[model samples]
Target: MPRQTILGIESSANKVGVGIVTDDELIANTRATFHGAPGEGFRPTEVARHHQKILPELIEAALNQAGISESSDVTAIAYTRGPGMGAPLQAGAVAAQTLALSFGVPLVPVNHCVAHVEMGRSVTKSANPVVLYVSGGNTQILTYARNKYYILGETLDIAVGNCFDRLARVLKLPNEPSPGYSVEQEAKSGTKLFPLSYSVKGMDMSFSGILTQITAQGKKLMNGKDTRWSKADLCMSLQETVFAMLVETTERAISVANLNTVLIVGGVGCNKRLQEMMRIMCAERGAELGATDARYCIDNGAMVAHTAALMYQHGVHINPYSGADYTQRYRTDDVNVVWRNDVLT
Candidate 1:
């Protein structure tokens, strides 16, 4: 029997990526990102256009890197379907559908959030752990139960990545790689931890208040009028405060679920400070912490392809001829995880 080869496309946000993978090996993963001005965020329309413009090249590059000249070599095509900007999601969906139809292969629609969790699990080999999913568009505590990822808690307002990005913009920080990355770099030089709003209600967390306070402070500092805090100081305080909330909530969730392992996924999961905080919490509780580097944690086609490969092996797929669809409000708990059947040890 021939090994199944899956091609994945991801354009849920500013990055457009393509990946090729076999059952147990990653062949190629390529991406193109759109960067806006330092103080401006990417608009949906512009991001969609960027994906559309660069997707073909990314696909070709991925296939070439994988040493597959014919599209027929691909067993399936998978793409991110929802819980992202609608226009960007549509760009990827349309490309996936077109590729699937042309190649005469199955098309799989993967939930972005589920892809992140599955990728983290695959990378860390974490078995039956409570998940802390954090990114630009989402923040949630999840655990698997009865073939579904149940959400234990989530953000009440803005996501942690968004909060970081907003603060970066206010301070006119470079958005070259990402605003969050820039903030993290600056935070390393911080000497003082300023007091900031920290809101964690029960299991749920909120970052809007912190963002608002930090944004105001950042603006004043950027205008060269405020001497109360340095850029590094502000960045460090923001991370310390928000990461504490996340750590506290995750600790509570782990305690309530009685789980011994905690897995962190999504774009913001790449942060060293956040990982350090989570590590401390897990260590204190005698639990283990699992996380992947940016290659797997950040939004990329590899994760989508990897998750789709798992689903395909389990006979989960859709018709290629049907209309490709996507949604901006797809929740993480909406996916019925048929591929996972692990028993907690």
Candidate 2:
């Protein structure tokens, strides 16, 4: 088959992204993030409005970056269909449908989680590996089986990224770029690891308890109480505790899957500390660790484009203008892996 370009749209969170990917390579990627008020989280409607307002400019920028004409150069239009904020997903869906109709191309629906895993594999070239997917809204350890990726373990409560973001807001950290990034920097200077709750239920973990403990500490710090912990210490401790839990769960999952390679994906995967921890764990077990830089780790359009292209090539696609819907709770195990070889695929 001849190589073709795929254009993808991603508006799963505060960031709105667009990118172009060919059958073999990513050509362009562009994104614009919406900043929320300090100590506040983004509202769904507000995020959707942000995406709607900037999507056009982002698409144009991505096209220009790819050095291509409009939809004419794009062989398929792919958009994140579910497992995200409704309004934001709708924004991407609408834009994608419009592009598909305009260009007379097929509209491919891409699962957000599946896209992350697929992107990780594409970049790292890990043919088959246990995947640790972590982000602001999700955390799960997955591996491919029968016809889908099965979740071996996941967060029982809040996601690790959400925990970090909330803690950052409580500490009055700047939200520029990302709160997690700011926390990572402050943690570098931290010298102590404070005591906090660590909850692990079998293969699953709970972050709510840890978050509650940290929140109380943050309040005490704000009130000028002599809690014997600095904000940096708290940040560092939070990261260490949460990342340790993640690494442990991933280690177990790797053992269960008996896989020699591990791939970390999603927004929180950009954390260097997490990568380092994973490296150590992989080394201890004599396994390979596969991870990408911020470009592929964070939520972006390129991953969607790449995944959708693979699906399209394998004759796995959805009809254009048939149904344009998004969901807030799409699970990774629900999607069928039609692009990759499986007994069902």
The most accurate candidate by TM-score is 1
Candidate 1 matches the true fold with a TM-score of 0.98
What is candidate 1's local distance difference test score? 0.92
Q: Which regions in candidate 2 have their CA more than 4 angstroms from the true location?
A: 342-345
- Quote the positional error of residue 285 for candidate 1 in Å: 1.3
Q: Write the per-residue lDDT of candidate 1 for residues 91-147, one digit (tens) a residue.
A: 999999999999999999999999999989989999889999999999999999988
Against the hidden reference, what TM-scores do the models get?
Answer: 0.98, 0.96
176 in model 1: Cα distance from truth in Å? Answer: 1.3
In terms of lDDT, the best-performing candidate is: 1
Q: What Cα-based lDDT does every candidate model obtain?
A: 0.92, 0.89
Residue-wise C-alpha lDDT for candidate 2, range 163-193, written one tens digit per residue: 9899888888888788888889889999988
